[model samples]
Target: MNLATHAALLGWIPVVLLLFASLPPRRALVAALVGGWLFLPVAGYDVTGYHDKHMVLSAGMLAGAVAFAPGRLAAFRPRLVDLPMTIWCAWPFVSSLANGLGAYEGGAAVLFNTARWGVPWLLGRTLLADRGGVRALAVGVLTGALVYVPLCLWEIRMSPQLHAALYGFHQHAFDQTVRWGGTFRPMVFMHHGLMVALWMAVGSILAVALWTRRTLRDVGGIGMPWIAVALVGTTVLTKSTGAVVLLAVGASVLLLADGARVRALLIVLALAAPAYMAVRLTGEAPRTAVLDAAARVASPVRLASLRFRLANEEQLAAKALERPITGWGRYGRWIAYDDQGRAATPDGFWVIALGQFGLVGLAAITAATVLPVVRLAVRLRRRRAAAPGAGPAVALGVVLALFAVDSLFNAMTNPVYFVAGGALAGVDVRSLVRRRRPAAAQGRAPAPVVVAGAALASPAGSAR
Candidate 1:
């Protein structure tokens, strides 16, 4: 590790610990997590390949939650997703048997990988499970964006020296920072420039959602609309093609939504990319026809990239099927190897999940992420009128849609993917809770459930 990375870790860990002692459980939890992801050292700071920052604050927060806020423990209680994740978590250890790397190495793979898979989503979901918590999270994210704006702008001019300047090493291939547009993309503290752009995109969408819902007006000081505007600008300047498109779509949805029942639309949107992915990865997709159709809107170079990417996924999927149920396991087990045993890196997140942990891993995550989204949509189908705080749910769906698009090509393993997943699940889960309450207390007839999500940028009681 570089001197700067060591220094940054020494700094953030203590600060997070202090906040744990001084701040409220939820606030401290959120602060430690949000702060860690935003400002801490990058990926090179690893404990035997695991990012120590993620393990320390993220998984640590859940343990802290159990000790400090036991009553809110229901947040960690898995409903539909519990079983699959159990399998997902345990399979790495089992796969180690076939691809055995011995006890110390194998155990470390399972232990750290589980922590990585669990921490980010758990921290967000556990702390931000309730209405007030979700709103706080929205505001926290916006504030992070507001804080990051100047840094993002400066990095653009300076050509992304923050990671190198602060951490003493770049987190990704420097060549990858090259943009299709004639400029360098900024990485800042985020591991990659693409990650920075996606982070900005998610923040801008949340800000735009808050602005459209008129909840930001309640928070005094700098105007919420201005914050959204600033965040949107940063997302564009980040020079990530996917993120810019995602932000524009989210902003358009928030601005143009007419309070109609969009449940069917949300389901279709959520399922589209995943379905297409499943087909393509399984070698059933009409690649030529689809690429030809897409060529009308894309350049030949982009189309070739897509085709080549799909081909890579096909090779990786075949490799995974050798083990099928349990997968190839760690030690670059999932990556395709040359005759010399040199590994070719896999591209998409789904293929990554399939290769490392098998279909079970993929299924667990899908259940955790996609099922709740569809369930929420189905539950909300009958409601012709918008609920009090349905805006956040709509916003979450839009965020998920954009994430779905990103997941088609990239692995959804970063902080943003887990944070957004937990946010969506936590929001929909409230509706699931309301469905089971007594009719008198619910003040409405029992149905499947239509969680209004959280108040988002609005006050606490806005959801209730």
Candidate 2:
């Protein structure tokens, strides 16, 4: 919206180029995706179309990938796992055409949607489809969150003014930033305080998981244990109860659960969004029970907020059912209006997808995001030993599942999850877990034990 915002948004193109030119393709992708998502202005320009920073970043990455990592792209063979994302990208165009918007509109929608969702997944699949690449991504996220620590703390102490101070506008309502008896819930560069909270919480979970697995000990010279503590403390300071709860659940699973239990939990989390949608559409949302449970723990204001969201979801569900198949197209066609003709807004992404693209679209998007985790879960279930060296991938799968769970209540979309999903989609469950033959059986000395990036001492007490 402002000069600085425009400059930062447009300027990221060259930054993407520089990253690719200077770093490895996978690392470049990670840096470009994470850095742009974190610091770029939320607004975008409408040169030919409404090209936001997300599209711009994806475009730059695509170009960089084409020039630098063409082999990855050339060798890409579409599999059953890719169908959901392909459909997710293609369905918008179909929905547009179904609503009589014609091919031009449909084609354009396809391009934008693919860039928003597909390109990131493709990049992850091509560039980060291995064990080292997966760890790099996990580290990239942890590093990005660590980078946000000071900015978040500053915003928490001083109010969420960095966006306004730097970009010449506040990204969201100022009142939303005030929480916990006037303490600040920092938004930093994200669209909402909750997003920042979720980011921090996820980082905290990864820090702990990686540290415990010994996959990572230090990020940029700081010890992982201290990094975990800082991230955990900052996540709590963000004042989002939901994100904190998710962090707790993820950490608990990683710490306490065995392979089977973790796999089961991942499946549940993966199914949560779809199940909620189905329940809402069938008018069996259990609103009263949910509200009663919320009432026990939530303040009156928070309780009212939940009640309002549920009520709006019911109204929106009714409206979405009018079209049923493809639902309404873009603009405000999918939105319900009251007697005063004011449009009702959707708070959750699942409802928004249902309204805009109907069941087919919703399922496509859900599968695109959630299916990879399900597949990874299945693999882990079958091969329990893979769970050790697969810490980063498992952490990513957990985050993806949590992203699905969060989509039920909030609508924040980060392409990094797609990156993680794509990685999981292509990763071999046994990639990181190396099998060593017994010394007696092989008539030779045993090899060193390495799991999750850390090497265990061999029989002679020497680390590899």
Candidate 3:
């Protein structure tokens, strides 16, 4: 890490405070989270322990929220849907202790996981469960993508030099920057080009959703149609085949499916990761067939990359199976080593979670991320097709499910998706239930449901 990287990381704390002071708590959280993820250095200082810039920024956001939005924090109530995340955050401690790594290490793991994963979920549940919160988040990410268009175009032509130019270091392997035929893949400040591409893809999904619902006219004064085109064009240019596929799948669903069909598709997508894990573990995965299919569509280089990842996954999964319950604990214990002292790298997040904490940890993390989407789907099913905020809610939920699917191949961790998940998990299901009841039976107008003595704002398009 360079001096500039140090300054950028340390400066983010005050920036968070400034954001909270200048913007509403919800927008502040979005700005701090989304903007920090975009521009902050990928490295951070070790004041007491090794903290990624992500966890450090998350801590700053949590502190800002507590200091400025105490009422919102105090108003948060834990639901059963939140239990999986609680477990996911704390599971590493149990695995640490099980591996005889002692309570000290175990406790540290808990803190890291909580900061990295739990804080954003809490933020979502507390500040972003409302109609206004939904709009802020969706539009915030859409706007962020628009902001990245120029940066991505810059990296595509000049070869991803911004992180190096600004932060004083390259974030990842230089070789990975160049894609097919020496085309540059923009890493921006993220860990990998694929991550940046996926971020753009997610923004595209939200743009399509907001436009389809007629909920958003403009994001930062750029019309939604133009915003959608920019995001979609950038996503394609990123040269990440997986990200393009994700954008395509998301756009197709938002454009073609009804609410019920959307919910059903989300449920299926939610189950995809766990299903792949089961098949991979049982050796029932049709690997050759899949590769053969890919070979026809994927470039030769891409096919070779997929083949290599599958080969490595086989070894890593087998090692993880050896431990079964609480797999080999951290510090590369779960990773297999060859006679030459080379470590087998686990590419997919699913296998890494399995190896690190075994099936218990895998299930916990998967449920934490996946169940919220499933819960939202079920709740939305009970709602009328025209329920306020239903369009963006469903669109955001689809992005969350796609994140789970993406985790099957890449270990890119974005807290924005968790924020979306928490927002979905925090949806006011009771309001939907009450709205379903007949107005005549209630002996009055079907008034909007009030929580804490305040009527929740209806989302856009309701003419409220």
lDDT of 2 at 173: 93
Candidate 1 residue-wise lDDT, 272-316, digit = tens:
667876786567766677777878876677788777876677778
Global lDDT scores for all candidate models? 0.64, 0.81, 0.80
List all candidate RMSDs to the true structure: 6.3, 5.4, 5.6
> Model 3 lDDT vs. the true structure?
0.80
lDDT by residue for model 2 (387-423), tens? 4467788889888888888988899888888888888
Q: Show the colliding residue pairs in model 2.
A: none
Query: Ten-residue segment with the worst summed lDDT in candidate 3?
Result: 449-458
Candidate 3 or 2, higher lDDT: 2
* Candidate 3 deviant stretches above 4 angstroms: 48-50, 338-341, 382-388, 429-464
Task: Rank the models by TM-score, top first.
Answer: 2, 3, 1
**RMSD in angstroms between candidate 1 and the native structure over all alpha carbons:** 6.3
Q: Candidate 3, residues 179-267: lDDT per residue as tens digits?
A: 77767999988889999999999989988988887776665446778888989999999999899999999899888877678778888
Which clashing pairs does model 3 show?
none
Model 2: residues with Cα > 4 Å off, grouped in runs: 1-3, 48-50, 381-387, 435-464
| Model 3: residue 299 alpha-carbon error in angstroms | 2.7
What TM-score against the true fold does each predicted structure earn? 0.83, 0.91, 0.90
